[model samples]
Target: MEDLFYFKLFLAFTVGSTMVTLATVAAERLGSRIGGLIGGIPSAVAISLFFIGYTETPQLASEATSTIPLTMGLNGLFLVIYVGLARWGAWIAMAGALFFWVALAFLVILLNFNNFLFSLLFFILSLAGSYLILEKGYHLPSTEKILMPYTPLQILSRAFFSGSIISGAVYLSRVGGPIWGGIMAPFPTIYISTLIIMAKSKGVEFSRRITKPLLVSGMVNVVVYSTAVRYFYVLFGLALGTVLALGISAASTYGIYWFLKKRMS
Candidate 1:
């Protein structure tokens, strides 16, 4: 049990760090909107569910998805809070957003929101609400490519920050049942890292610009992956299910990027 626990934590750290780094680099090279699109692709939840299914039971992994949609909905709220407070400062925005995420996630777990249909509905509402708030309300414009150069130390530090947070989340998630696991699996640690890095490197405005695109990405990518895996893992087994889910996610990501690019142009 102890060995497995450590392994899971390590895996979480690796996935969290790699995903954030890729998103950050993508933003720096491509642009914030593009970065947001990349960021929304499945990261922690994919690995989390895969490992949960591998180590535990496929059924447990499937059960763990019971609250994933609701948790993802909360993640959308997380972005909203960050962007809303961005003008104040990056630290303030990240801190405030994290507070809401932690508080609301706990509330979700306490309430035991395990119904798939309602959770899915909540997720949809969140996506729509977030779109309105960021795009229509704030009208945050997309940022140009940020020309910031990264040092090894900077990359290492950002990875450490994301890794530690996600490692903790992964470790604690297993303590409770599948519902708790589901909720914690999609914790906004990736978003927290990506937001802070982008804000600090480029500026708060750049980070804010990406929020809308990120929301769109979240709406399509995370939802598709989670929903697909909810059934795929059970029907096809862990390895095949993960591959199929990822294939679907990748295709949707391409479609989303194309749509967003057209809209932006």
Candidate 2:
């Protein structure tokens, strides 16, 4: 049992840190749109759900995914808040985003929002609303590649934040049943880490430029991943199911990236 617990933490930390480091680096080299898309991929959630199924049951993991879309909707709002408040300062932006995320995420738990379609509707609304506000209202543009040298500290900081958040989510999911697990699985740890790293290194405008793409990519990624997990985990079992779901997510992410790339061009 102790070994399993340690293993879970280790898995979470390794995946979290690796994903953030790669995404941040990609964002710096390729541009925010690409970086955001990469960052938004189904990294931590995949790991979280896999362990959920492994530690508990496949049905439980599938049920836990029901709230993912709704939680992802809240995450969209999370980016909106962060982008809106970013010009003020990192602390304000971080605090405001987190405050809203926690408040509304618990609202999801309190209301017992378990219906999949309704959660889908909530996610659709968030998808549309966040895009319009960020792209139309904010008039945020796609950022060109901003070249910067990588330092060990930057990588470590991003990894630390992402790893810690994901580890907490994984641990919490064990206590909360499927709904709690589902919501907790898709927590915006990557987004939080990305924003902090980018806002500090690249500044507010850069952060703002990335938010729309991040929203588009992140939400879509979660929706597809959760949907896949809901169905796939039971049919295929953990190892195979995780791979299949990840494949689907990768395909969908490519589709989103291609569309966004065309739009940006």
In model 2, which runs have C-alpha deviations exceeding 4 angstroms? 1-10, 15-40, 145-150
Candidate number with greatest TM-score = 2
Model 2 RMSD vs true structure: 2.7
Candidate 2: 10-residue stretch with minimal lDDT: 142-151
For each candidate, what TM-score against the reference?
A: 0.85, 0.87
Write candidate 2's Cα lDDT for 166-203 as tens digits.
Answer: 66666666776788877787888767766766777888
Error of 1 at 83 (Å): 2.0
State in Å the error of residue 159, model 1. 3.3
How would you encode candidate 1's per-residue C-alpha lDDT over 208-262 as one tens digit per residue?
8877766776655877898889899899998999999998888888788777776
Model 2 lDDT, residue 106, Cα? 88
lDDT of each: 0.76, 0.79
Give candidate 2's whole-model lDDT: 0.79
